[model samples]
Target: MSSKMQRPVCLLIWLFLLEAQAFEIPINGNSEFAEYSDLVELAPDKLPFVQENGRHQRSLPEESGEETDTVDPVTLYSYKVQSTITSRVATTTIQSKLVNNSPLPQSVVFDVQIPKGAFISNFTMTVNGMTFTSSIKEKTVGRALYSQARAKGKTAGWVRSRTLDMENFNTEVNIPPGAKVQFELHYQEVKWRKLGSYEHKIHLQPGKLAKHLEVNVWIIEPQGMRFLHVPDTFEGHFQGVPVISKGQQKAHVSFKPTVAQQRKCPNCTETAVNGELVVMYDVNREEKAGELEVFNGYFVHFFAPENLDPIPKNILFVIDVSGSMWGIKMKQTVEAMKTILDDLRTDDQFSVVDFNHNVRTWRNDLVSATKTQIADAKRYIEKIQPSGGTNINEALLRAIFILNEASNMGLLNPDSVSLIILVSDGDPTVAAMGEMTAGLDNLSINHFFPYL
Candidate 1:
């Protein structure tokens, strides 16, 4: 026989064996293998195979029993964030909607991140027109209930976890096919003061979101808005600048993505507001004390009482030298302290108190912040190193004693702005004077500052 004829004969024998094996099925009556028959029957239509007649042929098997349906996954549809800022605090609300695009019901999880130090409350979920609401509970009780629900395999409730600079919360809820679920979260955060401006940051990066995303912020400053500045990154992404009211005491800012804006890269996501939305407003620093600014029948009074002599200030800085502050944290602290010392006025008297397991002070008493004294303070801060455990109680007590002695010497007058800036990364591990509880009580009763 020729070699070509032998090759065809071998191929034919192989094909026969494959066909025989393909038709052999196990008849052990195992229900688990019942689904296998469906896949086998779908081979002709799903597989890419040629027929013997030199034509491409495909056919689906006829229904022998009930037909199975396919389901789609749930997806986020839209997200909105709204903020209202007053003189002291800012209230933010987030609303999101999720849609189940499947033919079968689904249980979906929704997660959100909020800024650190922001108090989150008033969480509500709406499914099928029925609303479920939750409130802030004690940590212990909330944890117990959350655990109980999970152990029972219940698809409900939520959990919160705190990260370095933010708190993340997640919740799970079931939704019917083709139905939409809505969630609302509310939180309040104190406005940050830097230099001469009050700032608020709204984080907008949740994930790849729908086309209808928007953020609206309204700020009402009783001190009267002197200037409002928005970063350049928000040039075309947002609109409606700080529109001051007729009285110039209230302002409104709105940010909405431009759907028709051209993208720099064709494949990149559209120019959505993916970063923090920073809103800064400069207050009228020259306003005299007892000056009133009214808007919409609401009145705000300033109480700085200008025309009097500028009060001398006595400042004390309590710094932490614990193990956790060994690297970047310590470096940043030292740099900030240097800048702060440089900014002190000549009339200001200041002292520095640093602690690890033992307390240390730069000077036994308050010293005027002269050019030489400020330079020396900076040098002392630079030479300090991070080590040992945190002694919060001892360090705070030493600060209090210094302030008291300065007051006894008539350095801290009635009109002076005596301030104590406590900087620490961890709780107290060693308390020399007493336990942490008693120390806190004493500090709270004896030490009170309008701003800390």
Candidate 2:
């Protein structure tokens, strides 16, 4: 052979040998595990993937993603979960069935990641809930395991979520190939009033080959609350009660108990204790709100309310600048007030009373809008800082006096509507909502009015 041709052939052979040596995948019989094919050449124990483009591309110490995407070798794994919850206490039981359907002898390791808020009460597992052994351990975050590979290095642990009043529990076990295993986990946790979604993860280690992952989750929310703001879905029953799920999701089960008054008086009577009036009053709200106008052709007009004679021309904003109103509340309140101020007309009069420990009026009397006064008032509101305790009663009483005095002076017309905007997160320490009722006599109040 020519020297040049021989040299070229030698170079090609060398390149092929280096490539084959660098990347190696273990095949188990006929079924080539897709997971094994996807793995990178890192520390065998580490089980990190080789990326073609990212920072870990062809690197020895590879970055492992938070969770692996391989199905557990134990094919017939079943999860049975039952939950019991009250206003205070929550209990959950999970029974897992894992069957080793793989050929040949293999030692399997199991691991589970539980949610944070849960307090583990019982964790037990057996081949058929009869006889089996397992070890359960709790480690902080990251732990290391050894593997056979060119690069042997440590990797950071999985990143768990950071939330208050949350926790986790796990159990580890090893099973020989062709054997079946069962795991039962029981836990009790403190129930939270807030509604949201919670997620938990389960991981299985098929040592040196690939890792398997599973996700379990629980959704917690006041079921009917989501329907509150949505229109035409619910009707208000007796005493402003929300009529949830008429015939769907909620079962229709109601029985009116027989009473002496109901049996005796079967007709209309206006007396308070009369049986006839009681029945009528009990069902009046639902009947009125739930009735289909025009044979279900017309949608319910929930926004309908008795309109006051005069439209409100003067509005007094009584704001609470308590410490709790620091971040989102302060920022949102300021933005809302600016929008309210912009809506005021030339004929409309406005004033702001800010209260924390003590009441402070931004302006002594109702300031009529002129070009400059409105601008100055906007600037003044922008600089108000939120701090201290709430004094809603004092601020409300002072606002009533302001409105009364303005009306007496003929500055505020009796024919014009008066509105007092009270914005606060809580009731006062010294004076409560009942104490402030008398002061709200002449003001027309509405909340979540959907003005837009």
Candidate 3:
């Protein structure tokens, strides 16, 4: 690499890393676990490929009036990602620079599949010498603005969509021939600790190789990180190793695979960088009270108790059988239920509540998930027919009522974990949904432990 080619990208990476900031919320921990409120959604974790030169694939006329025989090549000028984790809250940013190869206007698409729980906070595009930044607005208004920008050949991004284990969002910009465009996307998420470890999973699928590509991660765990390992099993095949440096409470991991290593084969220029780079670690913990850390007006509690017997679960399922879920949605729900019922433990008690305009239960109360009961549950799930409108609030309340009644009657073990899993098409009002969930949680807890 020449000094002549180094200044801009290096400066950009330096500035971007310095700008990556998050609320310093750290999770203190011990081996065993304590949890948040009663209700817990288990931790799940891991982009689409960037499409450049897709429309410009055809041979283009050269400056000398000769037609280039091969497809127009896309130039990925630079690629960089920086992740800064304070305690367990992480701020991540991805930056890429691409150059338009031909002397004609072309569309460059930037898409990435991010962790499902992470929310994109910022996105910007620098085209030629002009820069455009994203802003939050009402959906209708945002769409109208995006349309205007698209018409004016400006750049803007919107939306994150949920996928199996990841959600994706994309943005595209029209660049003039010889235009150099730089795209940056930033997001934030809290690292979750599950089964005694916290995972910092980064999804990587560049689809092609670039001259400069790197991922840098810095982590600070005040309770102290007990262990940190870079797992290469994020995807099928590829080497995803990082250089690790460590101190008592801080660690740095950098991965900068060379172009030779990024190639599919020694003689091939095709990229082999298509997999996740997983960093898994756990923090120090206390046997009692877990660990707590406070700094800069914010705090986080890391609690996972160690060596406790597994608590049996009283699990309740809330499924949507509304008109909108009439086809593929309902079909997938039934299929998922079929698999889940098959996995229930013998000591676990479970029931299902399916709702549309009205709510209905598969059983009068929770029952031990015996083979017979599991089989019956699967049958009931398959028979569910989608109709009418959705009743998300009432359905949640009804499910909670059943669990509380069962607990109060001694049918459910007070020592067991009570859980409600809702599978719905979608909620129209997010705020109301949150309120109802909070209210039902309080109701269930108060009913279960009336003296408290």
Tens-place lDDT digits, model 3, residues 339-385: 87888888899998888888899996999999999998898889888
Top-down lDDT ranking:
3, 1, 2
TM-score of 3: 0.68
For candidate 2, lDDT tens digit of each residue in 63-111?
2332221244554233334343322234555555555556654443334
Task: TM-score each candidate.
Answer: 0.64, 0.34, 0.68
List where candidate 1 sits over 4 angstroms from the true fold: 1-74, 84-91, 100-121, 161-179, 187-200, 218-229, 233-252, 259-265, 270-272, 280-310, 411-414, 432-452
Task: Output the number of the lDDT-best candidate.
Answer: 3
Highest TM-score model number: 3
Model 3 lDDT-worst window of ten: 9-18
Candidate with the larger lDDT of 1 and 3: 3
1 against 2, candidate with superior lDDT: 1
